[model samples]
Target chain A: MKIQVLFGTESGNAEIAAEDLAESIRNDNQEVEVHDLSSFSIAELQHDSLYVFLCSTYGEGELPNTALPFYADLSVVRPDLSGVRYAMFGLGDTFYKDTYGQGATKLDDKLTELGAQRTGEIGRYDASSWEPVGEGAVVWFAGVLEGVSATR
Target chain B: MDAPLSIAVIGSGPSGCYIAQSLRKALPQSEITIYDRLASPFGLVRYGVAADHQSTKSIQAQFSRLFERENVRFAGNIEVGRDISLAQLRSTHHIVVLAAGLSADRAMEVPGEGLPEVYRAGRLTRLFNAHPLEPTGVPTFGKSVAIIGGGNVSIDVLRLLIKQPEDFANSDIDDAMLAEYGQAPVSRVDLICRSTIANAPSDPVMLAELGRIRGVRFSCSDPIEVAEDAPRTALARAKAIGELLEVDPGPETRAEVVLHFGWAPVSINGDGHVRDVELRSVNDDRTNQRLGADSVVTAIGFDFDGGDWHGLGALKADSETGVLDQGLYRTGWIKRGSRGTIAENRSCAKTVADEIIADLDSLEQQSKPGYAGLPEEVRALAVDYAAWKRVDCAEKEAASEARTRRKFPSHEQMVAIAHNKLVESSAAQRGN
Candidate 1:
């Protein structure tokens, strides 16, 4: 299966997480490519690859600088994503309380509204927590990968 | 076409890496080599950043890419002054950037500071991060601990000391050291701050995070007063502290963190180790108090010894710009003192890079050997990126199931792992 690791970041944390996920996928002898969400056009949703979105929340739970363009593109274009499957991992600080992980939640909601199928739970990491966002995301995605294989 | 010059950047920290990045973009064909005393790169990001804040440390992934470029290289385990003189590097490279960060801890300058249980925040941070130079042993902070500072670093030390084992899941913290620290549970932590609640330097987010920790009580010496006309930052900070003070730890509370505003450390008093800290009010009231503490950690700041490191009696660089001699330059903490975040270092490096380009571009410059000009023994001692990757992998592979990675705390162990040498045992490698 072709896996696309899409990332949106403010401080490059999401990008690094996406790269780490891609590296892990490759280690498992799977084909994967990583891309910045800012550079990914909404039209590319027509592709049959499984998408894994790793995004971070910026100020007041808003989408990160890089993810904003992609989110806007998806909202306006509203491409048919009936056949698209995705998984989400969000980076946020619980210190923000009200808006924590809202960026990823908004993106996830948008995808589902567009008839896209999401596999596994939407993983969330709190910056205030002791665990690293990347480490937690990797652990969560491992379960998602297992589920994908089982469904296959 | 841009001038193809030889550039050597000392210290592979954020400033050095950013300097290399900016220089690479300006002069694509130029040779760039970043040098560090440790076997690994990402100086402070790897050693000074809190282990739990791996997201912040992930900036290293971007820096690692710079080393993969043919034009830029990393020379680890090489000190410019000790291994090869600054004069030799200047003779070899067109421009030499000194990004060697301030490593020395600024002394508290109070009596009884030389006690055994008193540790500098930098030293403790390094120990927890598993910096190769730090001694291989877990610190014992006993039941009561006193931290001197109101900065984010003081909060980081407090968090490290108080976090439970389960809280450390998936973190790359020194698990063995953490386990040892956990042996003697810290019941109380006093944060002695010279600034009031409104003026405290710690970030509001950090203060709020402390409120969320389970089984901990938080209190402030001075009540937070949020003024309607105050600055937005001050208001936010006051709100965060107010919220922290509202946290009800209840009877189940295992620990308490007290914030003492407008208090300056007069002395750290003890017979042999840290037994108590004496503090005097910074206000005109001039009241003094003695708080009993088993351990005292100071998170004040860091300093650089310009006299010993740089060959010049004192580095006579331009205060605004980092220009010293014609070919010699400086950046990061060495240039601007111990201030600015990692992001600020990026801009500082860019400014220095711009100056270097403008200075060397118009002039007819002679070619010089950059990395090739370093001593053969020094080059041999240096660990390349590939070898460093082996050490990185080994660290991860050796980690327990719950941890992301377990760092080798000694230079010998890291060097052995990097070189694929057969070390008898971890204990033997650490000479314990």
Candidate 2:
């Protein structure tokens, strides 16, 4: 089974993390495809069983510049996700309080609303942390592998 | 192994934060506090770097870690000389590192420069970047602009004026200002200089970066060219100054960036507002010319104002190893004069840090109470890191869907939101 990794980033932080995660997934001997959300099409949802969103929230809870097109198309057309299992890892700074990691939650909700299965919980990483950067994303990915393997 | 030492770093910008981070690494137990006049960190980075340069602004993420440390603290809305005197900080902390970067613009001293339309590049930069210190909103620069001095900053301002609103969609530039700039009838930019292109303070790389921007034709009064077989750096600069570099702008092009080299502005003349920039050639004949310009901007260097404010006088200290004067030190632009970029401050700061560590044993120790020593009234007025975060949330939350940030340009407005949150939090606490 092929796994797809998509990322939307403002300051290139989430994109770097997505690359790392993609490399890690490839090391697991499973075929994986990675793309930036700006270039990714909503129609590609039918091609894969496993879909992963690595996105960062920008300016309150708004989507990154690259991810807006994906969100806009998904919202207007309301793509059918009847058989897909998806997971999300969002990068955000809790300094913004109420608006932190709205990207992950919004994506998670939209996918579930369209009849897609949630393979794992929405993982949100606090940008304010110093020790072991983006450790939350790694911990969240651990939960995802179990679901992906069980489906395989 | 010893009692925690107190250290105060003035200016919560890149230099100040770097000092805190360096000191923390050297002395993990040291209590570090950063002070700023504004209710925000990343001083100039917030109010300096071009809006289009998101990658450069990303340096703040690295500085953000210093605030989260148990030993490090942010004390906002405090001026060292006014709120608490320089003497007070010296008595409170064992070490006080003054990293308050240059705040004043050097006067051009040219005739008619005193006109209202003629302004400093630093002032314009702050106004555009939404500096809290700059109470004034964006000033109007009319259809034609004449920029004096040739440097990266001159290129930066030119880039800003020529860019379309769509280019700023992903940037933290003021969305309202973007809308205002969209309607600006700006069609020409004249870069006035008193010397040859080689004498210009800006780098070849910066000129190359300016070249990459789309939709702008280039020309010069002189036949701009570099010698054959010039180095890569020289070749890039020659090409930047010589070529009419642009990307597929149809018809007559949107705007033109014309270089007026070897021409010194003799006067910035107008009736009550800017009308033209009068110039004299650097040649022996001293030819005179006047270009019709609605606005004139001086991009000449910055001025250091620390010593004049405090009783310190000139603010110069030996930056070789360290100043090594009564636990006082200086770094960044203030130390070496405002010349190098952000990365240059790191090495200079590290050298000072080494000196600080070397003298730690011999230096007299004091049981100082950093920000905690501030009177309740002063504390109330100061915006702490948490309160700033609330203001940050409010600013971001207020932005339009397509915009990156809705900045709190007015210092008064930011202070209101920051302090109001504190009042509500305290009121709720009393009820509880």
Q: Which predicted model would earn the best lDDT? A: 1
Query: lDDT tens string, model 2, B279-375?
Result: 8888546569999998988887777754474777765533454563777887777777777566567667777788788777765665677677777
**Local distance difference test scores for all models:** 0.82, 0.74
TM-score of chain B of 2: 0.88
Report the C-alpha lDDT of model 1 over A1-152, residue by residue, as the tens digit. 69999998765567667877888888889899988898898888745798999988865467876778888887898888898999999888664786688889989999999999999999987766646456787898999988988988
Instruction: Output the lDDT of residue B177, model 2.
Output: 64
Where does candidate 1 stray beyond 4 Å? Answer: A1-152, B1-3, B69-71, B315-318, B362-364, B424-432
Q: How do the residues A69-91 of candidate 2 rate in per-residue lDDT, one tens digit apiece?
A: 99889899998888887788888
Q: What does candidate 1 score on TM? A: 0.75
User: Could you give the DockQ of candidate 1?
Assistant: 0.12
Clashing pairs in 2: none
Q: What is the lDDT of candidate 2?
A: 0.74
lDDT (Cα, 0-100) at B307 in candidate 2: 47
The C-alpha RMSD in Å for every predicted model, in order, reads 7.3, 13.1
